[model samples]
Target: MVAPRDNWVVDGLGATHEFDRLHAVEHRHHHDGGGGELHARGRTIRDVADVLCAAPLDPRIVAAIRACHALGCDLRILSDANRFFIDAVLDHHGLRGYFSEVTTSLSRVDADGRLRIAPYHDFHAGTHGCCLGTCPRNMCKGQALDRIRASTAAATGGKKQRLIYLGDGRGDYCPSLRLEREDLMMPRKGFPVWNLI
Candidate 1:
C-alpha cells in the first residue's frame, strides 16, 4: 500500500504510535517535541532506520520504477515522509537516482541523526488555503501538484504536459481532482481514494 506521508509514514505498517503521542502534544502546543520517528517496538532512530533498510523490497515494483526512468520520464517524489526516511528507503532499494526531485515535507536531519519532519505548510502560521477537506493539516497534495506543474511549464518554456498519478490515500484524492482529460489517475484498488472516486 502507498503510505500517507502527511501526518505520518504508515498506519499499521511498522509505524510507531508512540511518536504519535508525542506529535500530538507538540502539535497541540505548537512547539517542537524534539522527537523523530519511532518504531512500534520502541526502538531508537538508528535501530528503526536499520530495520527499515533491511526490509524486503518487491522486485516487480522496483523493475517498474526502473522501466519508467528508462523511458526518460521525469519522476519526482511528493512525499510526506521526512527526507531522511525517504532517502534511506529509496537508497536501500537502489532507486534513489531514478527521481529528479523529491518535494518532501521534512526538515534536515539533526546532527544527532534524528529525522525531524517539517510540515509542508506551516499549520501554526496559516491555512494552506485549500477547500478540499481531505487534505491533511501538514500538506495539500493538490496545491503541491499545481506548483510542480507551474514549475514544469516554466522549465519547458510553457509547454503543456500530462500526468499519470498512482496513489492510494485520502490526500491523493485532492490531486486526482486536478487531473486534466489527458491525465491519468490510477488509484490503488479498494483504497480510500479509489472509493472516493
Candidate 2:
C-alpha cells in the first residue's frame, strides 16, 4: 500500500509524523521514559530503520539513476535527512553504488541504543554563512554545493561539471541559487522549493 504524503504511520501515540528514522527514534526516546500519555510502545530506532529499508522505491527513479550512472555522470545526493535513513533507502534499493557521494545529517546510536542526530555543519560553531538565513541550522545546502563543486573540479582537473539539482523542499532554495545559469533546477511542482524559485 502507498504511504501517506508525509510517510507517517499512526501508532499508539496518535498521529505522529516523523520524516526519518532518527526523528522517529528521538520522538520515542523523549516520551519512552516518562510513562506519559505518549510512549515508544516498545518500538526502537532499529524497528524504524527496518520499516524504511522495506519501503519501496519508484522504479522510474531507479531507472533514471541507473541511466545517469551508465552515462558516466557523477551522481551526488545532498539531503537534510539523517544518514541512517538515507543510507538505508539507497542500499535497500541497490542505488547506493550509483552515487559518487552522499551527504546527510550525522547520526549515531548511543550505548543505550538511543539515536542522536547532529547537524552536518554545527550552527552553534558558526560554520556556514548563509545570507538568506532560510536554510536549516543543521546544514546550508548552498555551502555544501560550493564545497562539492570545488572538490569535483579539483578531482576532475579544474573542469566543473554541470549541475542538475532535483529537490522538493525549502532548504533546496539556497542551493538552487548557487547553481549557474547553465545548470538546471528540477524543483518538484507545487512544493515549497518550486514556489520559492
Candidate 3:
C-alpha cells in the first residue's frame, strides 16, 4: 500500500493519494483538486521510463524481496503506478525478476468486454480509460492477502504459514490493522504500528 510520495506524485497533476478511493485526478489545466494538479510533465511513459531507469535502486528492499523468493514465499507487487510505470521502475531497478506476481490499476476493458492491455505508463492517455474499478487502492490489502492464503492452501495442502508485512504510510494502516496479533508491521522511519497495538 505504498501511496505515491516524494517524486511518486510529483507536481501533483493527475494523481490521487487515497487507498480506497479515486483521488480524482485533475489535470493542471483543470479548475480544482488537492495534493496538486496532474501536469503533462513527467507524465508520459517515455519520460517516466527515463527517470526510473536513472533512479537509484534500494538495495535493502531488493534484498528483502530476494530473500522472500529464496524462502519460497510468494512475492507479489501491488502498486498504483499503472502497470507499465511499475514495470519500468522494477525493470530499471533490476527487481522485476524478484516479484512472482504484479497487479496494477492499468487494466482496460473494451466494448466487447475484453481486456485491453495498455503499457502501464500510457494508461492515462486518451482513446482509452483506466480499468473500471481498477484502482489499486480499491484493493484492500486484507483481500489481497486472502488470495495469498488461498494459494498457500493449495500449494502446501492446507498448511497455514505466518504472514509478516512491512509498510510505511497511511494506506498501510488498513492492511496492518488486519494483521494477526502476532504478525509484525512497521512504518519505515516514522513510528511503530506495534506501539499503537
Number of the top-ranking candidate, with lDDT as the measure: 1
For model 1, state the Cα shift of residue 7 in Å. 8.9
Candidate 3, RMSD to the unseen true structure: 8.8
Weakest 10 consecutive residues, lDDT, candidate 2? 30-39
Model 3 lDDT tens row, 1-197: 23233244332323444311333342221111211222222244344356545555557877777787898876666443445456766776667777777755453333533323333233234312223322223344455555666886798898766767766544355566667776666556654433333
What TM-score goes with each of the models? 0.82, 0.78, 0.59
User: Can you rank all candidates by lDDT, best first?
Assistant: 1, 2, 3
Which regions in candidate 1 have their CA more than 4 angstroms from the true location? 1-17, 20-43, 54-56
- lDDT tens digits, residue span 108-183, model 2: 6666565566667775577467878667667788888899999988998998589999988788999999999889
Clashes of 1: 0
Worst 10 residues of 3 by lDDT: 29-38
Q: Which of candidates 1 and 3 reaches a greater lDDT?
A: 1
Q: TM-score ranking from best to worst?
A: 1, 2, 3
Instruction: Please report, in order, the local distance difference test score of every candidate based on alpha carbons.
Output: 0.70, 0.67, 0.49
Which sections of candidate 2 miss by over 4 Å? 1-41, 54-56
In candidate 2, position 67 carries an lDDT of 92
